[model samples]
Target: MPNTQQLQDLTTQVRRDILRMVHKVNSGHPGGSLGCAEFFVSLYQNIMDRKETFDMDGIGEDLFFLSNGHISPVFYSVLARSGYFPVNELNTFRLINSRLQGHPTTHEGLPGVRVASGSLGQGFSVALGAAETKKLNHDKHLVYSLHGDGELQEGQNWEGIMYAAANNIDNIISTIDLNGQQIDGATDDVLPMGSLRAKFEAFGWTVVDIEQGNDIDAILTGMAEAKALTGKGKPVCVLLKTVMGNGVDFMMHTHAWHGKAPNDEQLEIGLAQNPETLGDY
Candidate 1:
């Protein structure tokens, strides 16, 4: 497991990567990426069953899926920083021929990624399928998935949730980036996710809540609890409460910055709040 200082550094680096990648590409999502940085860093550095060596089948390790593929910047940064690939490859994010597309895909044969996800709400089912396959193989490794609050509006997600609970796929743990704001506006303003915790409970899944979405320690603790709750014949869901653009002040409270790239001046200001701990990509 990564030490506290290393985890903090990793999260800072991931946030920097999110900003730099989006500014370079001029067209990737940053709001969600920034908000989810700590969670991704904590997972790769402390929680997930990942290593420098990766296998497509994940024979003896845990798996992670990004259902809300729009947050690719944070996911790609975390994967690279975790040694899935060279950190320098992050410079090619969203470029013409780069494996780091606007969204993640196994089509590029990326070592760490197993599924192609961009269409939203599909990853939950993909994760469930992988978990079920692990059961068939008698593998004890678990599967984890992340979904956007807005993506929950997709009908496929409910289907996946029902399937996982009905079949008692207890080895999977899924989290929602409950930043309360999506591309359009506040989640409550756009489409209210009424009592998400209660909804999951009513669906027969155990639910946990993490109040501080940007804090690495809090995220780690919540994940540990969720993991412990697993294998008792119920899947787990973490309702993570986060701000849309967590680290950057200007980007934080509005939907305007959801997919907007910061100009040079804006970049400087944003980076000021999150100092460079690990070297920039």
Candidate 2:
């Protein structure tokens, strides 16, 4: 039962974490990470039914996978701030021997991360497998995952989509970060994915549109609607539209910040915009 204001504070703090972690290491993806701040905040804090303790084989609770692991800053920040691990650990991001890598790795034994992502286009299938197992064991909890819209360029995702529809894997809710930008350039300029909604529906999924992916309230409502659409004999997909570099003014509408760390001066500007909501880690 997290209140809206508390969620906002956490979202601000997560943005702060994303900016600072990258600034320290002079590497990591910040654009998509910043864009997904509210979605991760709302999901971990209020949307998903999670256990107090972390477990590898999440048998009786909801599970989440990060198909687009390059945005580990936002995921790590929200997971740490939500009590999955110590918030201070974010300081070690991307350093040698640190559990926090550029992309999440299960080998590090990080409590919140479930898979080794960043290869792209593999998460939807992983989530579908988890969802199917929940049914095999008669567990009612759901499986949630996030995929970058640009990552859909991988061919394996199409196979995963076809499998889910043919088998009616209705317990998984996968959201695509429809920011329309990727590392190389704008998605359209790089490898255009026309009509994500129509594509998903054609693949036999119940699709929902979250026009404001950066807004906490909109994400909560849209995700709840997506959850409601589950268990009705169809898989669910949410087309989450967002602006890259969402919180920081200079970074907002461009792809330049996709995987670049901010300089000291830029860090100051970014931090100034977010302010210290729940105190920086």
Candidate 3:
């Protein structure tokens, strides 16, 4: 297992990968990708007990689904750097016939992806089904999923949340990236779903809050708490409060970069802020 410093270094590199990948394609979502870099690094490197090899069924191994799949840049970067595929393959992002599409697709045989997301409000349903399947098969491993705060505006997510609690799907932990920014503008300005904590509790799910979602140690600690809350009869929800475009000074706290790629000069500035922690793809 990697220590805290190593995970932090990998997070910085993941941020760089997000910037470069989107900049090259001249299109893609970077704000949420950057905000959730630390969470991805911490989950893949330290939290989930993944197998050495990849498979679709994933029996006896923890599985992850990206509900908000537009952040494929960060997911692709972290998966590649974590050895799911060759790091150089990142260059093909959003290209014609590339496995690394704008949103993750399973039909293309992407190693780490298991669902076709980005349609919003469906990932939680898929994850609950997986969690229930694990129980049916007697597999003790967990199912994990991530959702965007803005994505929760979709009505299907609420049904999935209600279903998970009703069915006692305790082995899954679904995290919401509470970054406050989405494509149009701030989530509040768009459509505020007030008090996510209270809502989750009302739905009969256990909720854990990582107040400092961008910090590596805070994420690790909060996830540990979430893991501890599993299997007692309710699903777990982690409210990860992160800053959109966290590492880049100009991009922080703004929705302007939600799905916009930085220009040459902006890319240079973003890269300079993160520095080359591990070699770039």
Candidate RMSDs in order: 1.0, 0.7, 0.6
Ranking by lDDT: 3, 2, 1
Q: Candidate 2, after superposition: displacement of residue 185 in Å?
A: 1.1
lDDT of each: 0.89, 0.94, 0.95
lDDT of 3: 0.95
- Per-model TM-score, in order, reads 0.97, 0.99, 0.99
Where is model 3 more than 4 Å wrong at Cα? Answer: none
- Higher-ranked by lDDT: 2 or 3: 3
Q: Where does candidate 2 have its weakest 10-residue lDDT segment?
A: 106-115
Q: What is the lDDT of residue 240 in candidate 3?
A: 100
Number of the top lDDT candidate: 3
Residue 206 of model 2: what lDDT?
Answer: 98
Question: Total clashing residue pairs per candidate?
Answer: 0, 0, 0
lDDT string, candidate 3, 66-135, tens digits: 9999989999999999899999999999999899989999979989999899899899999999999999
**lDDT at 167 for candidate 3?**
88
Name model 1 segments beyond 4 Å from true: none
